[model samples]
Target chain A: MEQKKLITYTAGHASVRKQLLLFWTFFIIGSFTIGGGYAMILMMKRYLVEQYHWLKDEEFYDMLAISQVTPGPIAVNMATFVGYTQGGVLGSVLATLGVSIPAVAVIIVIAVFFPGFKDNVWIQRFFAGVIVGVVAQIATIVLDMGKRQKWTTISVIVCAGSLGVLFFVQQVSPIWLILGGGLVGLAVEALKPKSAGGASS
Target chain B: MSFLALFGVFFKIGIFTFGGGQAMIPLLQKDLVVNLAWVSMKEFLDFVAISEITPGPVAINMATFVGYKLRGLTGALVTSLGVILPSFIIILIVATVAHTFRTNLWVSAFLDGLQPVVLALLTYAVYSIAMGGIPAWWGYVAALGILLLILKYGKRLNLFLVLLAAGGLGLLMFR
Candidate 1:
């Protein structure tokens, strides 16, 4: 008949200090990560998985997979996933806020100080150089993903087919390609022998 | 544009666009620059460059930059919230369901299907950026150099250092 105390029930959970630490970790990673979400993946792995041991390597990959399949930036998705898994919804909110703060501050400053920033030759040259690095970063991601696949004949065909569609077609949306690839995968999966089908990776 | 309109447009951009930051460019161009005229073409280009060089997702950075341009700080906050809100909600839902469906056949198949398509998208990202960014011979050389450096060093090398080295190379060669 008596109401249980909420504080006592939640006592074993992470303290606010630990939550704040989670926030700061994401904030620092967000502040330092340049290029884009793909680049952020590598950083997240290094800091969250490798350095801190907050997440297991398999769990991190699973989150990365979910981040890709779902909509939104990988960085944001990752932050939300990590936070939720670690500290629940509050963790999610805090992590997202932390990751966003640095970008907001930097952009605001740039907007104020550099109204005519685009015309600056030095900035242009700097980006022209950074663009190369960004491309390489994406390339590295592609290689990393490619290496992860089990590489069956069906997968090889799917990879080539998707690449051809993307390369040759002018106006096909990636969303459609993604959906089609899913169908192809479903069909391939359905047709495989039961014994072989047991090995889903 | 009104605050509501700004939020609406960015929210739409957030949900509909896939393949991450670079993939949002044409959509942003069409909706914000061409249709609404909230941002100019030149400003959009500059925003793209700034977003790339800055420390967050391009989509979020663009949202903040444009939001500030339109309505100062409130605009920045509102637009960023708009852009990230969809992903946040979607990911929250997916994360919730993912554990329950971790071993489902259809789910695994769908994810497996996504693997190649994701690869294609990444490859396309590399191709598109290279087409636009690497116009000269030196640009190609620089790209090749960075790729080799990453391959050799793997994760041992810090990306920031690689970027800084590329910037230095750009200053010397591009100039």
Candidate 2:
């Protein structure tokens, strides 16, 4: 009976062990990551795409795009998607927990013991410096994505136009910008010839 | 605040926040720090800084930190759950349907459209953070150095190590 059950469950795709490995992988990545979700994307690319070959480059970029458009943290959204792809609902839960546990553990310790930690002068200076680094990291992602997209005319126009509105308009929600971009994409696709429209430039 | 109130507030934060973790700051400040007086503005700023430096989503870290401040481990559990619950449910639903519709032209086009906008949003993030003003010359130097280093050797070097090095340099120069 046990052998039969095992065979039934193991017909194809991820097994329990693979799910556990996925959990641990995210746990370690979540623990060490600094900066923010964008930073985590870099780490994910290194491990998931380059090291393990779990996801191809295009797949990773697609995931990144989906996570961005979704609500909540990009990292959490990504964890959910990746986990679901690998091992369904249970995998999603475990992966989310794995990524979150380290943060909760570390923060709880700091809150309990070093309540006044931020008041330290040296820590403040260090954060100031780190902020600069964070900015640089984000800039790198922007440039990297630009290169990957090959900076088509429409893409460049959309990028610059969005930036201009955000910079000049003040208080315009990014959601509108996102929606407008979608509309523009659809409109462009509708207008273009059948063959050209199908390809994402 | 009651645990239910805590959960409710965080759940609202989770669903509404878009463009990722940093974008949630204003909403958090408005609701928790400014209006509710749960934390002071200075404390909120400190939390933001701490959230960024730590190893997690800024929103999640903020929820956990604030919850711990308000009510210890239980509060942390509740608030974090509150924040995560919405996203978990939403993503689960989307994931279930998304795989089925992966080849749908409309869906693909929507995602494609979102790409450039997401890129723009990321660029804006860089701009806003830099606008915080570089107080010292070292800050600029550090920022440029990090940019160059990452551009050159990012694939080989661990980001955490670079961050640590930046912290050390900050201590030496800024402190």
**Highest DockQ, which number?**
2
lDDT over C-alpha atoms for residue B135 of model 1: 48
Best by lDDT: 2
| Positional deviation of residue B171's Cα in model 1 after best superposition, in angstroms | 1.8
**Chain B superposition TM-score per model:** 0.86, 0.85
| Model 1: docking quality category | medium
| lDDT of each residue in B1-175, candidate 2, tens digit only | 9999999999999999877877788999999987899999988888887887677888889999899889889999999888888878888887776663335556666666767888888888777776773458668777888899889986887776776777677777774
lDDT against the true structure, per candidate, is: 0.77, 0.77
Model 1 lDDT at residue A34? 72
Off by over 4 Å in 1: A1-18, A55-58, A195-201
> What is the Å distance of residue A44 in model 1 from its true position?
2.8
Docking class of 2: medium
| TM-score, cand. 1 | 0.86
- Going through the candidates in order, their DockQ values are 0.51, 0.54
Please give each candidate's TM-score.
0.86, 0.88
Query: Weakest 10 consecutive residues, lDDT, candidate 1 chain B?
Result: B95-104
